[model samples]
Target: MAAPRSVEPADLSPLAWRLLRVAADYEQRTVEREIDDILQAHISMLENGSRALSPSRCNTLFALYSAELTEEQIRAIAENF
Candidate 1:
């Protein structure tokens, strides 16, 4: 196996660029929600121990953000959880 090389945004197809942006945005939103949830007592930091979102929740958030992404992309993003 080899290390992946970094590429400029100009190197990506329009769709790929869009997907990348969406994924990054999703991550930011999820992290923000987790922080808010912890402060509001909606989730317990001591018990849960981790701030990661579940796969189903990721799917829901992705859906809320965009309908353009394929199912494979959605699943791939959710699997990060």
Candidate 2:
């Protein structure tokens, strides 16, 4: 499965971008949440770098974007978070 890539925000880590993209997709498709607004909030939280994906949320995100990333990749990314 090919992953989504962003050219901008060169400072943003690959994992950060993928995690946020998956979160946004979940928010829009599964939860019926207000995606654009909530996505902004998620982005803000991640940009600070002090915050990391909690265990539960990380699992949920892995399930949602499973095609784009693997459990190993998720764990590797979470280690840096």
Candidate 3:
């Protein structure tokens, strides 16, 4: 049987860590109960690697953070891994 791969902090791309941090911050600041739940789910995806900061997901994250990011920047972040 193969051993599970170890995920080190250094193994995560800068963009992945950035997305995870921002999502965590948003979860902390959000006042809306329903949206907070959704944010938690997004955080789970990022931490578990089930989902990544793809262009579409990046757009959603940026919107959640109320931060503006260009498509090119988004693409760079998405493809960093």
Candidate 4:
């Protein structure tokens, strides 16, 4: 199996989590199924100290989540340290 994504507790802010939750809700998706993937990817990026979210990926995620967030908001979450 591939290595698990590393994550730091502090790297994820409540606001970001809330946004993610809202996104999941908008899609009528369970957190376990959809939102978790994005959260895990973010956690991995945070732990690795890598800024690796591409616009295409963000768009795909937003579409999956049915999130109404703007590109700036998504970028902010991904760029947050």
In model 4, the Cα lDDT at residue 35 comes to 45
lDDT of 1: 0.37
Task: Rank the models by TM-score, top first.
Answer: 3, 2, 4, 1
* Tens-digit per-residue lDDT, 1-81, candidate 4: 211123222344445544654644542234325544455646345334464445454445445533455555444564572
Quote model 4's TM-score.
0.32
Off by over 4 Å in 1: 1-21, 24-61
State the local distance difference test value for candidate 4.
Answer: 0.45
- Best by lDDT, which number? 3
lDDT of 3 by residue, 1-81 (tens): 111123233345545545644543545235234243345556566656676645555444445443344444434444565
Per-residue CA lDDT of candidate 1, range 21-75, in tens? 3554644445446443323221232114344345454334334443444455544
Q: How well is each residue in 1-81 modelled by candidate 2, as lDDT tens digits? A: 433332223334645645645643544334225322334445445545645555455344434454555545544454554
Please report, in order, the local distance difference test score of every candidate based on alpha carbons. 0.37, 0.45, 0.46, 0.45
Misplaced by over 4 Å in model 2 are 1-39, 67-81
Better of 3 and 4 by TM-score: 3
TM-score of structure candidate 1: 0.25
lDDT of 1 at 17: 30
Q: Score every model by TM-score.
A: 0.25, 0.34, 0.35, 0.32
Task: Give the lowest summed-lDDT range of ten residues in model 3.
Answer: 1-10
